[model samples]
Target: MPDWATFAGFAGVVLVLLLLLAHASKSAVSGGTPIRGGVDRPQPGSVDPAVAEVHASLTNRVRATGRGTDPTHATQPQLSTLALLANVAVSQGAFGLLLLAGGWFTEIPPSAFGVTAPVLSASTLGVGVVLGGVLYAANEVGASVGERLGIGADEGLREALAPDSPAGWAVLLFLVLPIIAGFEELLFRGVLIGVFAAGFGVSPWLLAVGSSLAFALGHGAQGPAGVVVTGVLGFVLAAAFVLTGSLFVVVVAHYLVNALEFVVHEGMDVDWG
Candidate 1:
């Protein structure tokens, strides 16, 4: 059996960190900056091409609706892509360290976290790619349905996170998204559900619901509708993890979903909402 006391300590730290992140997200959206209405607008007088492009896109969206972009958010500052990347890298790196430390202290093997070597195959990767593509399509369909129903999502969050330069895009796609996907899956799926179940003998499906709620809450920056959408997505990912028992698969699929969202929505300007 694993060390219950140590596991409790690890869980406590993780919970605190998750709550902090969620609060920060809420603060980012709920502060003087309105949620950009439908899409993120550029900072006033910004010359960055990416910002310019986003502004143009936002303008077009507003024009299509025969309305103007929200003046409240017109002057709201856009987050620097590099700064956002650095912040995510540092936070996720800390999470990785905590995972390692917890494993060391509790004597939990990596397998308990779903890190297995045997599953690292081309076929496994292919499976992830397929799953990711399908999930992305499903998400688009859901978003379209939600839009038709007048249930709006916060596309501004994604727009603001989109990169401004080729180099920034590369970093976001190759490094940032993968780290986000990996750490999230490891914490939400592998540890919260998988390890806890193995260590405490609780039902993983129940844990899935609990962890999925946490996962959804962690994305509070995405707004209320986003929270609902994320909760459903989290559960689907959790189900995949529970069934496949492969962190690799879920990470890859998660990465693809995020990467495609950024690429298609922001980069390609194919707005589903």
Candidate 2:
């Protein structure tokens, strides 16, 4: 196994990449006309008076609050959301290049990098589906437990997943999420696990645990409970990677979990809103 110092340096590399994405996201856009997706979902208050204000002032003695408290409720262009989309793509791209460069330097085979599925048997796909369902159920229970413990919910992630408008929802569900699932599985499970286990001669299971922790920290914006949930999911995928060496399996599983969240919230109208 590599020394603690060595692992710390490796962690620093991941941190630098994450920090670069975050910084770029902050500076990527300016407040402009309604974003492309905003046409179908205009900022609600922009076109109308505050209904709560009118009601409170004119019709009732009690003061009432409108949707003003939740900025996400209004359909203005969310520069942060746009920036997040760009950051995930750019950061994942960089991660790919880094792995390729490492492969070349280390004289490692491309297959060793875990980019392609070594084998995709029907049994593997079936296992992935079962695992995906398990993750979804576990996350739901974990979230409820977290809330009871006063950890609250991961509103930040919910905002990204469930955009305010139809177009925003389309982009998030179709474009952004697939990319997120593919790239994340590739980076964490394929790349990170391969590097530590092969290059540093670390135990593959230990490397999986390390990558899972990094995955959790990557979602620091979601707070502690959110990190725990993400870490648990990461660990699940990592174990799958170690067993099957099937990139497709983890991607399908990850995508399924994400899709389930959207379906529950948007389609079923469950109250994570």
Candidate 3:
């Protein structure tokens, strides 16, 4: 029942606020430097041998622990993959919940909400079961496949899916993530699509495709392949929104996907790598 304009306005405000808050938090944390005084400080003219030794010891310890080092040089690829997966789960979970609530209250369905829903739930699942399985099988067929070769595919699938968190983190999730998610869906899927479709006097499909592509491009940090995958997924989600003319379904589907991913990952020891 909610029009695209309404959704867009709401989403835009929330997105701006979330970005601002995140930036502020980051700045606050990064603004200060740790101070080690007294014993660590050297006297004028002469360096204290004890202080130098202590400093060297501390430096060595930090290096050994892999802290205070360049991430590119020091990071373990497998562990990095796992961490990325975890982060994806968290972000998607937060975003999906926000969309769900917004859609529910606004009386929108999946068709209106955007591609984030059906793509992740129905379409992506089917694709994964088919294409993902094929890829995995091919890897097993002795093609010099390494561990976590399925990581890229799995990561793509998981991004479409949503995630859950411990109950303890629920409050924080509700406060921050939902608002941001709601805003993004409203702006990108709802308003952008609506305006473009109207202005160009084009079919909904065209508008959806255009908007989704734009959405994918916004994630340039993810690289070309990732962008292509996301763009395709975006188109699917947009189609769902158009078909149903509602955001509610999209939101619910998004939430379910994320929640399921979290539950699965938490319960299973499937090596992310």
Candidate 4:
């Protein structure tokens, strides 16, 4: 177990890294803000209803009839990933600072981060995969139930996962999904749990429950049922972290849940646009 200073040093490095990444991402997206519908049109623009209808019809027809992009392959989504990336990085960086101020990184278990040989055993890999699969199934079932109860998912999350090309899916699987999972676990589990348990002398289960509530409430954008489902899942994840003392375990499960959601439910779709 590392004392507060050791943990703070590691967190400081993470803070600096995330801040740099966020700055770069924000700069990259400084141009081309996403606009939505006619509401997003430039100021001082006005149109007659009949002319607008005609233009709308033509645009829709073109979208429906167009086969594919030109060989030049000049196409892009209405939005960019940079904004999302920047926000995540900035938020995580801020969380790092909070952890330092609160001395939340005190007395971390070595197993928390899965410190081990460079090469993992096959059995270890297998166990991780199985754990991830189980969590993935639970998350999916929770999301489904939430949807049935009219608790819509976060809009930004939905748009991000909308079906796109294989390249897009690959980008998410390799780059975005793991980053999100790791960031969330680092904040909610690693930092928050440490803060409560070590800083406040909270027991493991109590810290897990308390931090899990915060985790779920943080997804306030996802609505009530989303809060409920996520809160439950968050508790389970926190409990697992406490029991196994493996941050890697929770990260893997979280990543698989997100990746599977996108690939299985939202990756492949008949082109409707």
Winning model by TM-score: 1
Model 3 accuracy (lDDT, Cα): 0.41
In candidate 1, which residue ranges exceed 4 Å CA deviation? Answer: 31-79
Steric collisions counted per model = 0, 0, 20, 0
TM-score result, candidate 1: 0.80
lDDT of 3 at 24: 38
On TM-score, the stronger of 3 and 4 is: 4
- List model 4 lDDT by residue over 1-273, tens digit each: 457556656655554554344334323222311223312111111011111122232233324545223312212332233333333444544654555444434655533343335334565456557777987787667666655765534333343324356655555567656666766676667765654355446687887887677766554334456567678878888877777666676777777766666566565532221
Each prediction's TM-score versus the true structure: 0.80, 0.66, 0.43, 0.60
Per-residue alpha-carbon lDDT of candidate 3 for residues 100-169, written as tens digits (9 for 90 to 100): 5655665554544343444555654443344323333342332123223532322322221122334423
lDDT of 3 at 270: 48
List runs of model 3 lying over 4 Å from the truth: 1-177, 198-200, 271-273
lDDT of 2 by residue, 1-273 (tens): 224344435545755676454333222211111222232221111000111111112111111223333444333343344434444445455655664554555555545445454466787678888888998888778777876787754332343334556665666567656666766776678767865566667888998998898777665444456667788889999999898777778877887787787778665778642
Better of 3 and 4 by lDDT: 4
lDDT of 1: 0.68
Candidate 1, residues 1-273, lDDT tens digits: the string is: 568568757866886776675554455334323334534332222111122223334444445554344655433333345555655666676776787688778888677777788858896798789888988888788778876886645455466557778977987777767777877888888888888888878998999999889887776655566667778888988888888888888888888888888899889998755
Judge candidate 2 at residue 9 and give its lDDT: 53
What's the candidate order when arranged by decreasing TM-score?
A: 1, 2, 4, 3
Please give the CA lDDT of all the candidate structures: 0.68, 0.56, 0.41, 0.51
